[model samples]
Target: MANQSELDDHYTRMDKIFRLSLGEKGAYSCARFDGDFSMTTEAAQLKKYQFIEEGCKIKKGTKMLDIGCGWGHFVDYLTKKGVDAHGVVLAKGQADACIKNGLKVKHMDSKLITPETFGKFDAVTAMGSPEHLCSVEQYREGKQEMIYNTYFKQVADLLPIGGRYYCQSMVFGPKMVKFEDIKFGQTDLWKKEFTDEELMDIICEVFPGSWLPYGKEGLINPASKYFKVVSVDSGRLDYIETIHRWTAAFTAFNLQKYLLFASFVPDYLFDKTFRRWMRRFKIQANLHVFTREIFEHYRIVFEKVSD
Candidate 1:
């Protein structure tokens, strides 16, 4: 698992690139496009927030906390809907952006949050955050479930018995390849997923110290002790669609911005560790869905039952 500082640094380095490619809203998670394949990314994002609000039964005047809130997009949405929404993140870049946008966000670690640190809330959300909570090493060391249990307990502590918690995470799929066994110029994964192992190594460089859960069970079982799993939705296809849109966004960005990005291309090519992951990003989204099936995206809603 990434410590707070490492997570902050990763976001700091990638914030500008993210904003340039992901649009002004800066959503860094899978957008829900249940059936409307032609829906715009922004529209899909709205649908996702709506689903979360409805799924968690959030309404006007409800108190909510958005953990790992990126750029406060959802926080901004919830606030505009008359909900008392607060956000927490470890990324300085994101925190600054949130504050600049006049949002109620704190630059702090979500893991350290407790009732004492950030009062009780009617609901809590953690979109795209749980994937970073446990590392592959942690899972191998037999600490994944314990880590999740502790996290769920903390969330439960912040909510009343009937309060809700929403989470979206990436988990290792049924066909997940062993971390050590993954190779570039693949034999079975995909033909063009990566040109070489250096590109594969860049993924670690990009998301250093982060790892996803084995599967949804890795989350549900631990949370079962504190909350009831009310709903589970597989967003794998939606994520593929979302990434497709993101790639288009990157392509459609103004020429001036593209030129600016191009200036860094040489740097990426020269430094083996710079941005080799960019090449992987080209096919990774679709590859993960169609070929490798190594990762799965899920949205789950939970309600506090007992501590």
Candidate 2:
């Protein structure tokens, strides 16, 4: 188990690596993660918005707060429907992009939020970002419980009695998947070029990420102490579809990069090989679809109880 300093260092390194791999523009483009650029046709985006609207019981002119609002997509969507929407994002690049796109967003961490700066929001939503909490070892050490409790307690404090908080997260799926088995292009090379163990080794070699499929039990159980669970939606199918789209878009982007910069043979070869590996990810995602019991994602809606 890593200490707090170690965990912080890991996150700092991860932030740098992610920013380098997914430039400002590319990351925003892939935020929807299903390759649908048009908002009208974006099933995933639309579903998320729909969930927010329904769960919050939002009305025209209702005030809303979005946590981890990537590129302010949900803010724009809500505002377009006549809801007064505000958002906070930790990524300066994403916030800048949103501003350039004429959307309003505050740059701040979720833990830093308060009713003073944000005012009271009628509803709050966080999508697929809470997993950024401390590492699994920290959770086992009991720090995770305190962290999550404080997070929800803050959200509850920011809302009126009966106000709502909606969240979508990658929860514990049916089975525990090793990080190595799911990484891009490592195992799927030329006819099982790498075994599952080899893939796991490669994952550990390249990254120190972890995956836990706890379903809604851990998050929902604690949150229910302070809020009532109104709805729980599963996203295993959607997640699989999302990954397939991401792999496809990434493949296209890398191919274009290779064609434009052929002088970089090593990079080109890596892209070519990586594309083949992405196909393996598609297979794994599909496997989850068939056995959702072993793998699942969740969208949970909760309403604060008045103190």
Candidate 3:
């Protein structure tokens, strides 16, 4: 694990890289990054709107809150369906884009929300945000319960009775590979080249500000306290598919950029090497799926119980 300063620096770099990768368009339009777009349109149609449609059963003219609405995709979807959709995002660029696209999205942190300021909604969704809460408590004895309990308490506060909450995140898989085993090597041919440690180090380096502390057990246990887990769905196949798409897209983009600039062969080689490793990682992710083991992505739907 990195020290506080190191982590801070790493997040700063990540923000820069993310901005570059996304450009002024803060939305991740690539179908692969978001399952709703990557999977077949029919599959996305079934799952993407499943939670909201189910929650709509509780109230008509429903007001929905998207806790970390990225580019207002869900909000747009809801608005079209005649639901009053509002969203909060920490990224200014994303907020701006959402506004420009005629969506009601605000730039705010989840912790800053209040009953008066944000108002209660029929539904709320974190969508992969809660896992970013800082904690090592899950690895300790009694502390684990305290840390996770507090998390659920906060979530419960934001929801009213009969309100629904939805979330998607990467959870601890059944097989916890040591941080060192998943690396692949740099070879011209298609082969796994780096070690798992190297991959984790790169991820840490790239996303320093991220805090992904919750595992499968940690998340479900805490959530069970305040909400009834209606369903838990795995999206590992989506992740594997997404990464492969990213590898291909980045490779193609790099090659095109190099060719346009000055025909830099070295850049092409670097991209090719990265694509090779990414392919291997995709295979490993798929293997986990086949085993019904731990998954990299999971979506949970919950209903708030009466206080």
Candidate 4:
């Protein structure tokens, strides 16, 4: 899994850009669109949440936990509907914001979640979290499958028989470049001198210490041990639309975000690590990967059927 520091580097420090671009309580993950991209992103996000609510059979009194709950948007939404919604975020900024907004959230590691910690939840959702379950180093060490399997077991431990788990993640797609082709920590200017494969390497540069699963099966296979697959849907197009919307907002003038970015100018000029990190924004690498299907998004629901 991506360590706390790496996560903070990407999420905590850049929280403003995310919030500014998507608004205070916007959905940071891909919104759902059932072949109808015409709807506004907010509407699509509500649809996505509705799908989750129905899939989990959640009601006014249902207890739920949202893992990797960035900004606590879903948490706030559920709470408004009278559900007992709690969220856990690794990013300090997000947790603080949730608290400030009077949302139920804790700044803690998702892996530490257990019955002992917060007791059982009727349903658990891990939106955009599983992508960080395995780091590049862990993959290279051939521990990827074991890591995912263990994660499934941990999640199962937090649920009773028939409990539901909604998990959204980006998995390595067919077009993903070979592992060896990817490079890292090189201070080479963004897009200055890089081949197609090397350009793909910029993914790790932006989301340091994070690696994705191969395909939906990469998630279902391990999860089969403790849960039964309920539904699986390709969210590729929804993500494309979501990215396009976010790109527009990000490129739009935001004094605070720009000023925050400007402060990094000195680091970008002198620090190699910061320079590499900055490269992710120079060209918006996320859109490239999602557009090319180098990363495939999956929205899945799993039912805990066994211990």
Top TM-score prediction, candidate number: 4
What is the C-alpha lDDT profile of model 1 across 218-284, one tens digit per residue?
Answer: 7888899889989998888888788777777767858666877888878887875455445545545
lDDT of each: 0.78, 0.60, 0.55, 0.86
* Backbone-clash count (model 3): 13
Q: On residues 1-307, what C-alpha lDDT tens digit does candidate 2 reach at each position?
A: 2232332333332333233334332222212223344433256556566757888998788889888776566788777888898887765656666667676688667777889986899998887556555454554465766767777788888899999998777665655455434554344434545444444433332223333325688678668767989988776665665655555544454544545435445653677644443344434533343244444567789998854
- Ranked by TM-score, the better of candidates 1 and 3 is 1
Q: After superposition, how far is residue 76 of candidate 1 from its true place, in Å?
A: 0.7
Quote each prediction's TM-score.
0.88, 0.69, 0.66, 0.93
Better of 1 and 2 by lDDT: 1
CA displacement after TM-score superposition, residue 228 of candidate 3 (Å)? 1.1
Q: Candidates sorted by lDDT, descending order?
A: 4, 1, 2, 3
Model 4 deviation from native, Cα RMSD in Å: 2.0
Q: On a 0 to 100 scale, what is the lDDT of residue 74 in model 1?
A: 95
Regions of model 3 farther than 4 Å from truth: 1-46, 55-60, 135-147, 177-192, 246-295
How many backbone overlaps does candidate 4 show? 0
Residue-level lDDT of model 3, residues 1-307, one tens digit each, is 1233433342232332333443323323222224454465334433556654674342347877877676676777778778888887665556666787788888766656776766778778766556444433233233555655776676677778767887766665654455335342322234345334444434433333343543656677877878888777666666665545444543444443444435434554678644443444444433333244433667778888844
Q: What is the lDDT of residue 116 in candidate 1?
A: 87
